[model samples]
Every structure is written in structure tokens, then in C-alpha cells.
Target: MSSLKLKRFIKDSFPDNNLIIVSNREPYLHNKSGSNIKVEMPAGGLTSAMDEALRSTGGTWVAWGSGSEDKNNVDDNDRVAVPPGKPSYTLKR
Candidate 1:
């Protein structure tokens, strides 16, 4: 489906409700790259597909923090706004 149709479907289907996706595979992983931490998206077809969905639509994705520096990037609530700098949704790790 197109982006417009998908968005319309979401608006019509889940009005006023936050979309929450629970998955074992994290979309973005923060690894310790020397002194600076760098984020990397996992390599997988499913992760790629889900990531597109999450990026286009605002929602919370609950997944395991499986990165080298995952613990250091989160707030007090163990949550981080994902897609980095311009965050669209929360990643509850």
C-alpha cells in the first residue's frame, strides 16, 4: 500500500490510540565505536520492514536493548526516542 493509504488506514483504524509494537529484535542498535557511540540497524528483512512501518507512523516499539552501549543512551525510564536526532517514537528497552 501507499504511504497515504497506510496513514489513512491507521487514522481510521486506531484513532486516538498509540500504536505499540513489541518485538525481540531492536530496530536501532547503539554500539561502542571507539570513544563515540554509533547506531546501526540490524541486518534482517523483518527488521527492515518493521523499521519502515515505525518510521512512517509514530508509535512505541518495545524491544530488548541488545547493543554494546544500549544502557548508556536511555533516559531514567529506560526509554529512548528512536531514529536518533529527529525522533518520531519511543523505544522502550
Candidate 2:
């Protein structure tokens, strides 16, 4: 099972020599309530490292609002279907 998932991840990352990330967690987030807004901390370790690597390599990282409630839904703008706690990663065109 784990192997399959890894394979899929690899495919998504290097599909046609493109590196993209589609996840339910964004690197950064902003929380808004009424007139007050707050910024949340980003993911740690692996997530942060991945973000850095992508940036250095000119890859892509697709994540949720990093704290948005609608992250589980498929965004109309990107047409990406993300789960409640998991996101999809694909190569950017």
C-alpha cells in the first residue's frame, strides 16, 4: 500500500518532467473573523523542506488555505480535488 502511494507521488511529482504539489495544507494561512485577522504558522520539517526544495527548483506547491475550511472541496479556479486532510500534488504546466 505504501509503495503504491509512493509510486503515485513520484508520478505526480515528475509527470512530464514537472514538479507540482497539490495538498490540503498551504504553506501559510490567514484567519479572518469579522474585522480581525490572524496568520497561522506553516507546516514543519518535511513540509517546510519540500516548500524550499520546490522553490529552489522552480517547482510548484499546491496547498489549502493552510487553514481554510473549504480546503476539502474542489477549487473551481484550479479544478483540484483535495481531501479534508490530504492534498494532491501534480506537475505544473
Candidate 3:
């Protein structure tokens, strides 16, 4: 989808700066119940391939409730959180 198009464009145009894809949801689920959930995303084939292609790559995934504020505990230099005010944030480097 979006990522595939982006990948194609980047690969054809600018192939320098490493790429990192951060999504709101990881692919797999650890558990889900009572409107609460947990996930354990694996390095699936696509993810691994993307990681391999990018010279320096990483991603930050998030988990939040439908009607709750974010209580983030992890603070990574490259990681970003899409808070309430900003539903999504994008960067290119």
C-alpha cells in the first residue's frame, strides 16, 4: 500500500538516507480482551527485507486505547509518538 509506493519511489529516486517505517500497530497479537490488547510483532519477511535494505533502520510502534490518553514509558531518540493533538507525524531524512 502506502509503504510499497513509498519504497518504490525512494528506491528509484533517492537511495541514500536510510529508511525507517513506524506504524501504529505491529503485525501480530499477543492478547486481546475486554477492549485491552497486547502485541508481539515479529521480524517478518517484509520487515526484515526492509530493514536489510536500509543502511540504518529502526521503527517505533505504539499501543493505545480508543478513549484513553497515552501513558508512554519508552523514550527513544529516534522513536516518536502520535499523541492526541497530532494523530500522525511523518519525517524524512
Candidate 4:
């Protein structure tokens, strides 16, 4: 099925509710390089599939951030608003 269809299904299944994704691996990773941080999205996984829907609806993605620069990117509670610009999801580490 298509992503739009899946999104529709999810919305239909759970209206007036927030989408939460819990996983071991983070969808996006941040790597520090030469005083700059490079954001990298995983090639393919559950995160890739649900990213669009989450981006559209705004939600929370909880994951174990094991990246080298993960700690620096998160807030006091280890949560970060993602996508860099126009963030729609909270990445909880």
C-alpha cells in the first residue's frame, strides 16, 4: 500500500490522537564534522515509512540515541524538535 493510504488508515483508525513511534534506532542521525553537524536519514526502515505521516501530523518519535553527537542535540530532557526547519515531531532520546 501507498504511504498516503497508510496515513489515511492510521488517521481513520485513531482520530484525535497523537502518533508515537518507539524504536531502538533513531530515524535521523547527527554527526559533527569540522564545526558543523550533518544530519543523515537512515536508508530504509520503519522510520522511513512513518516519517511522512509524522511530519504531516506532528508527533513524537522515541528512540535510543546512540550517536556520538546525540547528547549535544537534545534538550535537558533529551528531547529534540526534529527536521531542523519547521519541526513537526519531538525526537525523545
Which candidate leads in TM-score? Answer: 1
| Residue 75 C-alpha lDDT in model 1 | 95
Question: Per-residue lDDT of 49-81 in model 2, one digit per residue for the tens?
Answer: 565445344445666454453243335563332
True-vs-predicted CA distance for residue 60, candidate 3, Å: 8.5
Q: Cα deviation in Å at residue 42, candidate 4?
A: 1.7
Model 3, 1-93: lDDT tens digits are 355665576666656653455544332333454666443334678644443333222232333322221123223442333322332332211
Which one wins by lDDT: 2 or 4? 4
The lDDT, on a scale of 0 to 1, for candidate 2 is 0.49
Best by lDDT: 1
On lDDT, who's better, 1 or 4? Answer: 1
lDDT of 4 by residue, 1-93 (tens): 676777788788889998998888887788887788888787776778777778866789999887778889989999989877768799999
Candidate 3 global TM-score: 0.27
Ranking by lDDT: 1, 4, 2, 3
Please provide TM-scores, in order, for all candidate models, with all chains considered together: 0.90, 0.43, 0.27, 0.84
lDDT of 1 by residue, 31-90 (tens): 999999999999999887766666778898999999999999999998999898889888
Candidate 1 residue pairs in clash (backbone atoms < 3 Å)? none
TM-score of 2: 0.43
Candidate order by TM-score, decreasing, is: 1, 4, 2, 3
| Residue pair clashes in candidate 4 | none
